[model samples]
Target: MKLFSCPSCDQVVFFENVVCERCNHALGYEPASNAMLALEPTGTAFTSVGRGGDGRQWRYCTNYDHGVCNWVVPGDGAEPFCVACRHNLVVPNLADAANVALWQKMEIAKRRLFYTLLQLNLPLVTRAEDAEGLGFEFLSNDPTSGQHVMTGHDDGLIVIALAEADDAEREKRRTAMGEPYRTLLGHFRHEIGHWYWDRLVRDGGHLDACRAVFGDDTLDYNAALQAHYANGPRPGWQGEYVSTYAGAHPWEDFAETWAHYFHITDTLDTGRAWGFVVNPRVDREDVLTAMINFNVFAPTTTIANISDAWLALAAALNALNRSMGAADPYPFVLSETVLRKLGFIHDLVHGRVN
Candidate 1:
């Protein structure tokens, strides 16, 4: 995250600030430019000092009425909504008091989604009225409605139920899935892998390489998922697949690994910014290798493996958490198999393969 400023006093501010500590100006995120903006209230409408792409004026989406966002849309970018807000298809029933709080938690996680998307330069678009493109729908089965609640992804779209925003409900699902760690942001990252692999890997001449690691994604997803649940994974899945369910199908493997790649990159970038590492370059493989002794990403081009870099950071995170009497920050152990996946991800990210 780049540093933000309080537009009122020109003093430095943080991303999640609702009111500037320096000058007390209200602040909200401008998703189009991924910048935090300072605002002055004028009766019903607020004016912000930021321009969207193409030099358009903007303001917070009216959907804040529904509690799903804290973002502004470009005035002349001329969309009816903000970039993040535009993705909504069926929002939850906010008339219910509990749903309002649920929606706010989802917004916080969704904003983090936008931050990573902006940083990675991913393409984002909303599915317009009965039109085709990337889109989203926040839905559920209220018993009043016949449809079942599902958090699933399909054809460049992802559907998440409002209930998943609840911590207890999500923890229930995570326990059922037999996972070590899970969170709303993890779900967002995993689903996004499905969207991005469609753009980055399929039919982009990366199919063969992806197949070698993730398996052929050509099998029927429904069938694979059924088989996975019915019979479980092959005897020892964690030895090969990063996650147990990832071994169920090629597509699942790819999505899981892609999510892991995002996790590694984001954490490394944060570490870089906080001065955990000496270099500030955006690339992870190079930056991480220098700080840790063992290096492995891009072996043909680089000196060696950077396994030690990750280890060092992992140690620091665990130590910090331990100091606070909290669980270790990273719970999973990285075997050689996982490191190879990380290397493949590093290579793919750096255009070493392409």
Candidate 2:
């Protein structure tokens, strides 16, 4: 994500900012312009206050009332929710304060996912637009059954367990699962990978190309997963798969690799925005040097550039965490085979696959 500034006061702001601290102006993000507008109340609607202002009235998304969204829509538009919130098919009951708080956290991560998707200019359709269009369901575990809600994707609907918003509960699960990294944003990116696999690979007629890289996804998924749990990941799986769980099935390999692609590109973009350059003085071979000066989100950007810069940036990030006595923010290695998988995703996203 890139840094944003308040349109009125020019003070640096964040993506989720609802009020600019410097000028005390009400802020709303306009996705079309990808700008944070400082607004002036105009009856039930608002008017942009500065530089990019066009004098057109705008209204905050309906979800903004719940304090979970800060996006704005054209006042004359019929839609109540902004581009991101419109995909939400189900949300936990907001009447309960605890659920509301958790749901807010879920929305924050979900919006960041959408920001990346929009940046890539990927296809986004609501369930109302297509039968298998992208949608979301933030659900809580059934109180009566005491069954936990699984965070997974079905067709185009991505279900996120509200419990994952709780820091202690999520950390406990992460430790139990032996995962090095886990977050609401990570979950969104991973599950959406499944949705895109359906759109870009399965239905987009790239199955043969994908299979060549990810293996035969036609393998029985349930059997593969069952065996994965019964027996551990295949020996020496690290050389080929992004993670042990990715080795369970070709489908999972694709999803895990897909999620990594997002992770790398987005983090690199942030580093680029900050004008970060890594050139460690002690490096003898210059293997740990990078200049993060390119637009990583560009379709024309080569995967080699991304991979090189990511390695440098990730190494520096891990070192910084160690200095603070914290776990590495990125603990996984990108092997040669995994890089090949990422290349496929890069090509697929840019329609470069033949």
Candidate 3:
């Protein structure tokens, strides 16, 4: 989650920016270097290489032709597709004008997912097989398309209907799920949790470790899923669970915690870049300890933690929303359990947690 800048102009840029606002420079993110490069097209728009990024070769994704992306593939790559596009098992029809724009929105979120995954040093290796590879299917989600398709995951691939990318549909599902916070990025994080479980939880090595903190993962997933649907999470679920679904199973708890980890790090790193929080140098144990003590054992820490930060951030975010006449950018509060989960994830990623 370290800040990124436009390589050409040195202007700070977000991962989702398609065109630099400061210089009006065409832009594309290079995953290998984890950068947003200012593009200098060397050929025609459709068949051109952008003059910047790692190895000095970059080309826009084919979906860009359909207006669904502006990201570049490695210019020298024979595949002629961006990393994100390279993983597409299927993309819904773009001829229908609505699908083009909707898919673009999905790409924006997906790219953000890639940014965080890359930033965290998470392994996102893609494979052709059903069980080992990470992949995605952006489908129409139309009943007419077929009875086989559903918004779910199989092996390491996540299948999200293009429907979920729509504002109304996403909101409807969020409400139906009764989740205080839910969004495309959240969905990506949660799904990737399943991806990583498969990635690192083999040989029952992680079974005991995961169970120690999140509870047993050995429960029959199908039966647990059924029980969860039938009974829902226990009352006052937040006392011990990061999210209601987290109480369902160990795999779910891991996923829920995993999502919160992405949320906290990206937000914290972003806050630091914006000069909202003082950042410390590497070994950051002081700031880490401060954040932990403040959030987890507040009575013991003198410095402020996320609770205080959230209060200020919430006010500012709400005011910004009010100024724009839009909904608040951040929609939920973080509970204590969620905080501990984040700490766990932070340590695990840094190899501090075993």
Candidate 4:
């Protein structure tokens, strides 16, 4: 995500900031302009108070009252939620304070996912608009069944387990599953990848091309998953898949690779926003050198540029983590085959492929 600034004081802000620390102004993100606005309350609504302010009134999404969202909707608009929050089919029970806190964490990650989707100009339709439109449900374990909510996607609805919000619980599951990296953001990206596959590939006439790259998704999904758990990831998966889980099935490969595509472009965008450049003085071969000067989300941006910059930035990030004794922030390595899968996603999103 790009770094935002408090429009009133030009103080550097962040994606989730609700108030400008420097200017002491209330902040809200306007999705249409992809901008964070500093606001002054005008009755029940707010008026923009900085450069490019048209004095137009804005109102925070209804979810803002719960301290979960900071996106704004036009004051005169009929919609009660912003573009990102409108797709919510269900949310955790806010009556419980513990649930409220967990849901807040979930919303933060979900909004970041929407930021990249919007930047890519991908299609987003609420379930109200279409039966198979993208939607979300934050659920907890069933009280009766005593079964945990599986974090997965069904058709267009994505279910996120509230248990995943707890750092300890998530880390435990990550360890048990032998995943090097797993987080709420990763869950959102991976699950949404399935929805996009339905919309862009299955429905958008790219099935044949996608199959050639991701393999035939028509294979039995349940059987494949059963085999994956029983027998483990396919041998030599590292040479062809982004993650071991990706080798379970063709659909999974697409989703895992799709999430990585988001990971690469979004992280690269952040690197570009901070004016990051990788030029190691000690290295004679310039293979590690990269300048994140181009917009990673642009239609014109090539997968090669993104992959090169990401490799350089990922190295710096991993090194920085090691300096503090933290695990590598990025743990996956992209092979030539994985890069080709990512390229297909890039082209699909940019309308370069049918």
Cα-based TM-score, every candidate: 0.81, 0.98, 0.79, 0.99
How high is the CA lDDT of each candidate model?
Answer: 0.68, 0.93, 0.68, 0.94
Q: Candidate 2: which stretches are off by over 4 Å?
A: none
RMSD of each: 5.4, 0.9, 6.3, 0.8
Local accuracy of candidate 2 as per-residue lDDT tens digits, 106-182: 99998889888988989999999999999999999898999879999989999999999998999999999878899
- Order of quality (TM-score): 4, 2, 1, 3
Report, for all candidates in order, the number of backbone clashes. Answer: 7, 0, 2, 0
TM-score of 3: 0.79
- Scored by Cα lDDT, where does model 2 land? 0.93
Which candidate number has the best lDDT?
4
Reference-based lDDT, residue 193, model 4: 97
Better of 3 and 4 by TM-score: 4
lDDT of 3 by residue, 1-354 (tens): 456676666778876677777777788766776667777666643222233443365678877777667677766667766777767878878678888787888888887777677665666666654446888888875567555455667787798778888889889988998876778888888888888777665432555565677777778998998888899987887777777888887788889888876666566556655656332355354322222212222223211354455445555666679899987766555576666665565555544545
Shift in Å, residue 144, candidate 2: 1.0
Compared with the true structure, the alpha-carbon lDDT of candidate 3 equals 0.68
